[model samples]
Target: MTTFRESLARVASRRSFLAVSGLIATAMCRPALAQDAGTPSASGWAMTDGRGNTISLPTRPERVVAFSPVAAALWELGVRPVGVFGPFRQEDGSPDPQIGEVDLDAVVSIGDWEEFDLERLIALDPDLLVGLSLPDVPNTLWYVPEDASATVEAIVPTFGVTPSDRGHLGLIEDIESLAAALAADLDAPGIVATRNEFTAAEAELRDLLAEAEGLTALVISASPDEIYVANPSWFGDLRFFLAAGLPIIEPETEERWEILSWEQAAKYQADLILVDNRGGGVPFPVLDPIGTWQSLPAVQAGQVGPWHAVAPYGRRAFSNIVRELTEIIRQTDASVVA
Candidate 1:
């Protein structure tokens, strides 16, 4: 694993963003268009963000920067960012799978999820900084360090959609709205086709769920020490499943997740167990040796599978997940112990 300072040094050495954005800043400096047409500027663009702020750019920002999932959404809509910050790089120094086909060669990382290189971000000279924002968190930039938020915002306009804010469709809609403002061709054939595909997949899942009545699911983030069960209220994807007529087992608590002892985890039996597949969680093969995890009905029944708790939240991503879950539900044995 690369250390923070080492990552910073790596980005500083590349000096890529400064060279890439020669056209972006120049567009920002261009004169505003006529008011006779009632538009701020022919190039000006604006949209209301998840944090309830209207972020406007003097010109349709050509140089955008974001994380992997966000980059995927933008790419699907025909816009590619100039930089992408993420949790880790692969052994070959590529961004992790969470980014999903983003052009790693084109974008630079500020650092890992919890850290940022302020000077390096300034070096990007980005016209806009896009990211995820949660609901009711006064701060709008997601995953950004609190100390660095203000400074980063001051340097370039920053805004993002809250993936947890609405249903799966709602989340994509927010991204679509933002993409439209950035001049994406929302009506493009490929983009429209993806949406249609999602609709069809969702309908198929709905029919499958109807036959799998009483089937239940649990989403967990597990580690060597403890288990974190997701609270449906806190995640749009989980909520989407809950709303789709599937009975998702909810954790007892107000927080987004409930921490449990391994023994306690075995107490709540579910027909399906969705393990968090993010970098920190324990893998299925590794968990199989653990006595507590193996004792669970779902685990013993081979009902465990990877859950993308943080990645692939776009239209196609959500569609794929729904279809996957539907297949799992179809094959699930609903008589499992609780």
Candidate 2:
């Protein structure tokens, strides 16, 4: 995942806003509305997380707190919870906010690292507490003293980040697993419709990339320290590389992201550079400095631009991200003569 050397800041302007709700929130475009108590799922030990964390839940849990964004996929899959660790805008410039839009009023706030109030979490009386099994960096990282990983397993029934090999996995896997927990199938009409839209958008991106001269592209952030770019493995806009038949610039590395310098970045025979706005690659703002350098030929040619971060697996905005990424690819690729 991308790491920001400097403190991360959210851009306030609409120039960097993109969302595609799956119509699940026709009720949410407004303000708060009371929702009836959600029905619970059956009794049993459901599944295991990425790190092999197993949860033996007695009954469908009514109170739930997700420590990872991928867990949002659970809500879409019919696993509604009382709390969520979501992507939110902090009011006081704190690394994380106390609570954001993810909470449905009925849900109590069980925050992430910056705002993890273990006391409040215990008071909330959660029947099931789920956590990310892996230390996928910013996605989910909690301190476990010695053998912290094992300690976490002992404390709460933590699960791993979204699975990678599963076709329905990635960020989206959260929805399916969550559905099983909530006893609600979210993929029927609303989720399925959004998925179809994304499929079409991805197809368009592939057609545009394949038909046009393959632009040798480099991935970077606004800053030098951050340069982990995405391919098919990392979801979000990067999916286009695979769906569009575009070739990726793969470097030898086992980590989620790698830091690359301008000279090294310049060496890439790519026609474009797509910045990872998510924490997985380079922090978003750092892309500005890296993109405007006159010494670099790609910047001079205006082949550098930022890809807005979106949960490729998010149930609320997955389709929206696809549309935005497609537009970027189309507009950016327009400069290249076929």
Candidate 3:
């Protein structure tokens, strides 16, 4: 609900990278001493599907593959996927995108999480497949729903990122394990590098984001009521901003948020805001809400910023966008300007 100009005013109040590196941003440094090193096996990772079937894997898997957006984290961590899950635009056709962002062309499609082309997946001959389905989602049927229960024999070694309901963990842990599984030296230590990046950035902004700051935010679309709250779920890509201990303003009763109405925006009195731009609405149902949001308090207070075009969580989504965010936040953080 905040105006761009207004948000600019508070950026100097905040504080805000690199190889064009993906979120993994693996820096060439002394080996981090593998977190999973000398471990009997990956502790946090699983090699079975939801059906109780075990997904087989080669010890040193090189031709890796995945079947969901969540699995893309493997790619960001240096796993060149041979297959992935993406919109095929066809009910019965190949999973091809009229528009591609993350190189869906890298491999074949297993068909969206549901309607998975088992034959297609087998055709790719991937050693591992990351599968998860939100319990409430209709497509829950397709998620490794049974695990290796049905075809435990034919299943490849796969990793379940998290509990079915927790899509966020599925995305984050998948990347972490994918890197560890590959023994990828190029990005093997990336997890530490990323956490370090977040820690350094957060320390610098401690003053600006002082817990007592009590800054409120209403990150709704100016065009519609699409919410972009910094929940652990979707916004994990923006972990740096959230981990910075930046104050959040939301209703006391609510622990998470998806969208807030204009009245809700005015009521919460958020000190900051984020707006999603859908290239005029292709990505978000709402195009721009400047007409309705121009007058919100956060906008009046000048603490709003334009949300990026991609998902702001997980290494897969943030790999390419952190660079842009770095510039935006650096310009806004009051600490940086001072």
Give me the overall lDDT of model 3.
Answer: 0.41
Go through the candidates in order and give each one's C-alpha lDDT. 0.66, 0.45, 0.41
What order do candidates take by TM-score, descending? Answer: 1, 2, 3
Model 3, position 43, has a per-residue lDDT of 42
- C-alpha displacement of 49 in model 3, angstroms? 9.4
lDDT of 1 by residue, 183-292 (tens): 77789999999999999988998888888867888887676556777676656666677777778788888665577877786756798998766553337655666799
Report the C-alpha lDDT of model 3 over 45-149, residue by residue, as the tens digit.
334333334334325555555544444555555556676653333333332221123455566766542355667767777666554322223222223434532
Model 2, 1-338: lDDT tens per residue? 11233223221211111111011111111111112222334545455444444455766566766654444556545555665544333434332211222434555555533555565655666666654332223234332222344433444555444333332224354445445545665557876775677678767776777766655565544455434433334333444354456555654554323445554555444556665444434343445565424445555656665554434245345555556656766666544322
Identify the leading candidate in terms of TM-score.
Answer: 1
Evaluate residue 198 in candidate 3 and report its C-alpha lDDT on the 0 to 100 scale: 48
TM-score of each: 0.82, 0.68, 0.57
Top-lDDT candidate index: 1
Q: What is the lDDT of residue 328 in candidate 2?
A: 60
Least lDDT summed over 10 consecutive residues: which range in candidate 3? 14-23
Model 3 TM-score (2 dp):
0.57
